[model samples]
Target: MRLHEHQAKKVFKDFGISTPEGKVVNDPDDAEKIAEEINSPVVVKAQIQVGSRGKAGGIKFAEDPKDARKKAKEILGKKISGIKVKKVLVEEALNIEKEYYVGFTLDRGSGKPVAIISSRGGVDIEEVAEKTPESIAKEELDPIWPLHDFKARKLAFKGNIRKEAIQEVSRIAQTLYKIFTDKDATLAEINPLVLTEQNQLLAADAVLNIDNNALFKQPELAELREETEEDPLIRKAHEYGFDYVRLDGNVGVVGNGAGLVMTTLDLIDYFGGKPANFLDVGGGAGSATVENALDLVFQDPNVDVVLFNIFGGITKCDEVARGINEAIEGRELPVPLLVRLAGTNYKEGLKVLNDEKLRVVSDLEDAVKEVVKLAGE
Candidate 1:
């Protein structure tokens, strides 16, 4: 799950983070009204989930209400990064003297949240890390303790923040950590945390990605998800109650566990073929779930072959075979299926697949070679 800029800003404002005063508008008149209410030089910014709105001409500056209306008309309904600009955030424009980057994300190696601050901002962090690695300051904090005042102060000093701004930055970092933890967010980023001419700090732009597993606790945040920019097959997979990620290959994979699905992908690649998608039916998948997974895989024109690798422990391989049989009988499969069944009821599972006239293999390497050869033909 991911929250749009407007929703993320709402969280920031609630946590005492100073942000540009803005209101969302759906039309030119609404933008004009907001401009009048603010009574300042306003910026009309398209509200889409994708980045680089500035490069895509989705952001426009207006000196007055007339220009604001014109900018809104030009932006509304226009596509930016393939997403139609349905709403615009009309915000008071500020004169920025300096820009900084502030973000909190999980450090995979450390297995904890890491707070990153950089003086060089408003550009891709990856590029900055590769080109000028020294500019970014990172502080890995304990999950139980999270960010502390001492660590926050240390980060400020490392980032070369001014003495006067040290306290403010420290406080901002603390609040940001709260936002990150309390909301169950995987990433909370504010690019170009700007310093205004008046010497006030504000967040000029924001991006947040929430942990999908934690959406049950954050219903309000989940509402901010934009489905238009998402892969069609992926969206459909979710709707059908399965996990799917569209990949760039021809082998379609269906498995019960995450590890098995990954191995399936790797084996396909090992045999000179790329995986078309990663579809995990999850434990206890029934006939309906299996049918839906097959539907999604066959929908992909890129998929020439399907692979079902089932390692049934808590998830019975026999049940998975039944689902596979149900799917094959229910729909016109556009591609061939190569199945490898192991663990509980492996023999029974193999019997079911063989009965369906589906290609069955016991060895993963041999299955990969056969599938790759079949797809290439």
Candidate 2:
């Protein structure tokens, strides 16, 4: 779950982090009024979850109320990165002396949260890493120990920040760590954390991604999710009690576990084919889940073929075969289906699917190649 910029800023404000005062406006009239109230050069930023808003011309700097109104009018209802701008954040633009980046995210390989800070901000962090890797500073924090004040100070020092502002930076990092840990966030970031002309530090832009598994504890953050921007199939999968992710590809995949789904996706890619989605039926999945997975997969018009790679650990392969047959009984399934079922009731499952116009293979690699070939990859 990713919070909108305004929501992320609000969370930062709760932790005593300074952010620009702003009003969210959905209409031009409200925008004009807010701009007049601010009485300063304001920035109109699109209220969308996607990034690269600046590059998409979704952010505009206005010198006065009239300019703000005009920019707001131009931006409202405009589409940026495929998401319509329903509202704009009218904020007082700051005169920045320098920009920096600060973020807390999990380092998967180390199994701990890592703090990253860079003086080279206002640009993509990936670009900074590729061009000047030495400009960024990183520190890994143990989950059990958490981030300490001295460790934060050391990280700021490693970033080559001035001694005079080390305390301020450390304070901000500490607050961010608390926010990240307490909110069960997977990522919390402040890009272009600006040092104003008055030597005040403020977060110019903020983003926070909460851990989906921990949403029960953070109802307020969960409500900030943008459902319209999410893939419809994902929502459907959740309701149907399955793990699914929509991807941009031509082959549809269904499996019994995350590992199998991932391997299927990789093999599809390696065989010069792209997977349309990752559908993982849980360990105890029934026929209903299988039906739902097939329905979701067929909803994608780009899917030229469907692939079922099921290693029945808890679920019997025969039940999965029956569900597939049931799902395709009356449906206008235009594409071919390739199935590879192993483990429990293997022979029985083969018999259940033998009469259908399906290609069955026992070898995983051979099945993947055949599916790609059948899909004209």
Candidate 3:
């Protein structure tokens, strides 16, 4: 889950990391009060989940309490990256001597937690990597022993952080790694970890995104989740016990397992078809589960066509076929269905799905190709 900057800073503080004093406010008047409390030049930042707030005018510096109020008024009702800003963070502004970046995130390819450090900060890391790859230093950490001072120091040294600040930055790196692991976070980043004019290192901006699947262990962080920010279809999918993720494409995919769903999505991509969503019904899904998955996919307005890839094992292909039949007969679905049934009862599924509306394909590759072509990929 994405935490607003104010919430992320609180988590940083909880981990003994230094951060600029800040408070989250829903009202412009409260922003003024918070700035007055700080009694200094403050940064009035809109509390939205997406980044590039500064570029979008979601972040503004306040000269004083009155300016803070005015800035908050301008930001609170504004939209950043298509998300309406409901709150703002009033934070003490800092005089920066230098800026650095530190983060701990999963490297899915390596199946490891990667520690990243850079001398450059307050900018998109992707932009840095794209334009100047040498500016970033990354170390893939062992999951059992994620990060140590030596490792962080090595990263700091490689990233060319200042000599005097290397030790402190390394310490912060270790702490950030600890938070990454302890919180089951998918990403823990401190961008623009500023070295103030006073020679104090503080995390000027904090970003912590915990894994939603691990939220069971992080009750406090779970409370920080904004349900309203979630897509209604995704929330419904979760409620219905389906592992789902909405994507930006036209073809909708549903499979029995995560690996299967992922493979289907990859094939769609390879075939030049954009996948609209990833919906995994899990193993042992019955007829009702199949229908539910279809219903969920059908709810997506972006889906031009729906593809089902089911390799029946514990879940019998016949039950899945029955579910498809029931769902199709019950309603005239807006999008056409492309069904691929393999493994046990494959023949029975093929026989059952004689409906003119269902385009049943026995081969996974053939099904993907057909669906992509039909979706105008």
* lDDT for 201 (candidate 3): 97
Q: Tens digit of lDDT per residue, candidate 2, span 72-137?
A: 999999876446788899999999988888899998768899998877878999888889877788
Q: Please list the residue runs of candidate 3 whose C-alpha ends up more than 4 Å from where it truly belongs after superposition.
A: 32-85, 92-100, 106-112, 118-136, 143-146, 159-165, 184-186, 191-201, 209-231, 247-251, 269-276, 300-305, 332-337, 358-377
Among all windows of ten consecutive residues in candidate 3, which has the lowest summed lDDT?
227-236
CA RMSD, predictions in order: 5.7, 4.6, 4.4
- TM-score for each of the candidates: 0.67, 0.74, 0.74
Give per-residue CA lDDT, model 1, range 34-138, as digits (tens).
999999999999887766788889999999998999999999999763467888999999888887888999987669999998777778887778798787888
For model 2 the TM-score comes to: 0.74
lDDT winner between candidates 1 and 3: 3
* lDDT to native, each model: 0.84, 0.85, 0.89
**Model 2 ranges off by over 4 Å:** 39-42, 49-75, 78-85, 93-99, 106-111, 119-140, 156-167, 195-200, 211-216, 219-233, 244-254, 263-279, 297-308, 333-377
After aligning candidate 3 to the native by TM-score, how far in Å is the CA of 227 from where it should be? Answer: 4.4
